[model samples]
Each structure stands twice: as C-alpha cells, then as structure tokens.
Target: MDMRKMFGFLFGLMVSLWLGVSLALAQSGYPQPTATTLNDFAHLLNANDAAAITQLLTDLKNEHGIEGTVVILNSIHDYPTGDDTIEAFATHLFNTWGIGDKADHKGVLILLAAQDRKVRIELGTGYENQYNDEMQQIINEHMLPAFKQGDYGRGLYQGTRGVIATLTGIWPPDERPVQSGGGSNSPTPVTTASSSRERSDGRMGILIFGAFVVIVGYLILAHIFGWPVGNSRSDDDDDYHSWSSHSSSSRSSSSSSSSGSSFGGGRSSGGGASGSW
Candidate 1:
C-alpha cells in the first residue's frame, strides 16, 4: 500500500468501470444487436436469416437511385456521454443507409449531398437542444407523416427529395412529401438556365475580384515608382522641343540661300551668253 500503487489501482478500476457501463448502456439502449450495412447487406441477402432479409430490403429502400441533393442546418450540440448516445444511433443509420462515415465535430451536419441525392441525418447525444429526442421529433412530425401518407415510393421517395427543396428554398408544404422516381421511366429534372448562369457568374465574380486586386496593386506600385499607368512617353529635359525648332530654322535658311544663289547664277548666265555669242 504505497501511494503510487494505490493511484495506479484507482486508474485501472476507473477504466474498467467505464467500459462496463458503456457495454451495459448499449445493451439496454438497443436490445437487438446492431445489423450490418451494405458491406454486410450482400451477405445477409444470401443468408438464411429472416431478420437479415428484412434489413436488406430496408437498406434497398434507403439506398435507391437518388442524386444531387442539398441540406442546410443551423446548429446541433453533441453529447459528451459514452458511445451509447445519439451519435451511435446516427452511425448505425448512416451505415444501413449507405451514407459514408462523417465527423461529429459539429453536432450539426449541413450535409450537402456529395453525389447521391439522399439525405442522411445524424444527431449527437451531447446536444441538449438537438438531442436524439428532437431528431426523433423531426422524423415523426416532418418526415414520417410524408412516408406513411405518400407511401414509401411516393413519400420523400428518397431522403433528398424534400431536403433538396428546403435547400433550394422551395420546401414542399408541411403536409406534402417529395416525389419518388426509379428505373428508366423516371423523368430527370432539367436544371434551369438561371441557376446555371448563377453558378457561372459566381465563378466569374471570383476571377474578377482577383483581377481587380492585381490591378490595384499594379497602380500602387506604379505610383510608388513614378511610372505611367499605360503607354507613357517620357520627354527629355535637354531641349527636345527646342532642338526640333532650331533644326527646322536652319533648314529654312539653307533652302532660302540655295534659291537665291540659283537665281543669281541664272541671271549671270543669260548676260554672259549675250556677250560671248
């Protein structure tokens, strides 16, 4: 019984106790064992278990042919409790639904659909405001009603349906559900020119902003160096205009003298010719 030995024993005891508690909580929380995902879906499909077959069919419904989605969220708080929290439930959902693993860093997942137009929701137990209960509420009030009334095929059809509209600022009325499509007959939505234009314009705006910054820097540098902005011609201080004027005057004088000499020579030639002939 030295102090160091006692401390070490206490630490070990705490770790063991925490693990036991977590295991217990998980069992109580989800009495049935967690089912495998698509990775295990294929195996379950071939497996003889009735329960496994049902889960696979559920996966098919959750992971059907949806693509191009959007989601917006304000905030979500994460529970610091052990793995038995809502986060665990969410991980289970994502796996069954074929949504990839995601970080629970911010309790909020403003999930912008990467490729598949399906929405996946995850809530952390840490958030009191956004605990599993609230999420269940969203599912029950907003989500489930759509599914039950519209039919799984007709309801959101897929997770992305209503969520996409919400992101696009056109969420269906509270009572309505998103339409579903599958196989070859489903009509693909044609994106309007305006949205395409907006995307292009957003890119152009970035480029233009960058160019403007460069031009401003160029002007500042030019001002500092006393260089002209564009196409500048510098004049010499050493009589550039004066030199041109002086040269022109000299040329005029020479021309006048030449003319006078030619006239005098012509007159002399005429007078001398009369005498010599």
Candidate 2:
C-alpha cells in the first residue's frame, strides 16, 4: 500500500477502536439520574421492594423535611468520575442530583453497587458531622449482613431504616435477653424480678445515653453557631451470589418517566463514607 493510504487506514482503525471503547465504557458506567422517585437503575430490587422503599423515602421527606434517595447500580467500573473509589462516585452523584433542599443543603444518598459489592452513604454539607461514623456502623452492621446474604432488598430496607432511626432518635429492636445479678444470699422474689427489669432498662439506657451524647453535642454546636438541629450529614459490602436480572423493561420505563426530576440545587464537599461486603 502507498505510504499515504497506509497512514490514513491506520488512523481510521485507531479512531474506530477508540470510539468503540468509549461507547462501551459509557454503557458500563452508572446510569444518568432520571427519576427522583427512588432510582433502581440496576434493577436489583423487586417492584414491591422498590415501591416500599420509595414510600419510606417520600414519607421521610414529607414528615421530616429530610431529602434522601436510594440508588442501586450493577457496577461502578465506568463511573464518570473516573475515581476507582465508590466514595467519589457517590459524592459526585449526590451533588449532581442536588438531593437535598437547596437552602438547607441536607441530603443523603444511599448508593449500592451490586456487582461491585460496594455501598456508600453520601451526605450533603449540612450533615457531614452528624451522619458520618454512626452511618458507617449502620452499613457495617445492618446493611452488609443482608447484602452478604444475597438480600439486596432487605439490605437496602434495613440500611434506610437505620438512617431514619438514627435521625429520628429511635433505637433498633434488641432481642438479647436481659441478665440479672444476685449475691450469694438469696434475694427476695420481687428483688430478683426488679433486678432483671433493671438490667433490661439498663441496656436501653445505654443506647439512649449514647444517642443523648450525640444530640447534646450537636445541640451545643448548633447553639454556638446559631443554627438548628435539623442540619446534619449522612457505607459496605460482601460477596455472594449475584441477583438475577428481571424487569428491565419496567425499570427503563420508570427511568424515562423520572427523567424530568432534577436536583434541589444542593451541594456536597465530599462528605460521607463507603464500604464493601
């Protein structure tokens, strides 16, 4: 072949390969934010589960004026942020969607990557301090267990409830039996019963105490800054069998309907954490 023709052909081949790779990468990346009504782009959760979660989120917003959403994706390999860490991708999404009220900047995004076995709770600027460590614990303790068990719906539900409970000052149900201590001398029957009750109360007291500490700390900070308690900020994974793909058509149609949804102009400074199960 002539030198000019050879160079042209090589250039064309390179361009074609590059375009193909770019298109594939785009396809693999996270789906664009479409619906404001609980996006399940990866189709991880069933319709019933998705509806329930959506209602929970909506109620949280309506009753508490807190803005939050759950996002489940198949993978983050092609996340537009190009950051290997799920944390970055989540933060980017949180900001991109403006998940919270613009004035309050209070937003929480629960991002779960099923194939990647990763999860993240990304918070807006208002919630950085309030939702960080405790939120991490919730993901590690509540969400990761369900995910590891191949229960994405349960995992997301539990995780969402955990966040709500934390914010609403409610404690999760405890199933552990209470213990009673007694001396070598036999105690009165009433005393024994009371002791057991006291121990049970003590367990609840500890949890309340912990929560009180957080609330008081938050209040003090708020008072010092002349702000209110409504402000706050808001991870993990495991390996197991992958969920079967189903209802793609429904999901796509939902996404299209939700395309009109937009962010509330909220922003984030990379607040929140991430984890894997």
Per-residue lDDT over 16-57 for candidate 2, one digit per residue giving the tens place of the 0 to 100 score: 566456445433334556556587766566566677778777
Candidate 1 local lDDT, 69-88, one digit each (tens): 11211111111224332334
Q: What is the C-alpha RMSD of each candidate to the true structure, in Å?
A: 39.2, 24.3
What C-alpha lDDT do the candidate models reach, one value each?
0.31, 0.65
Model 1 lDDT on a 0 to 1 scale: 0.31
Query: Could you tell me which 10 consecutive residues in candidate 1 have the lowest summed lDDT?
Result: 268-277
Winning model by TM-score: 2
lDDT assessment of candidate 2: 0.65
For lDDT, the strongest prediction is 2
Superposed by TM-score, candidate 1 places the C-alpha of residue 102 at a distance from the truth, in angstroms, of: 23
Q: List the residue pairs that clash in candidate 1.
A: 66-117, 67-117, 77-127, 78-126, 78-127, 79-125, 79-126, 79-127
Clashing pairs in 2: 126-232, 127-232, 127-233, 128-233, 236-275, 237-276, 237-277, 238-277
Q: After superposition, which runs of candidate 2 have C-alpha atoms over 4 Å from their true positions?
A: 1-30, 170-260
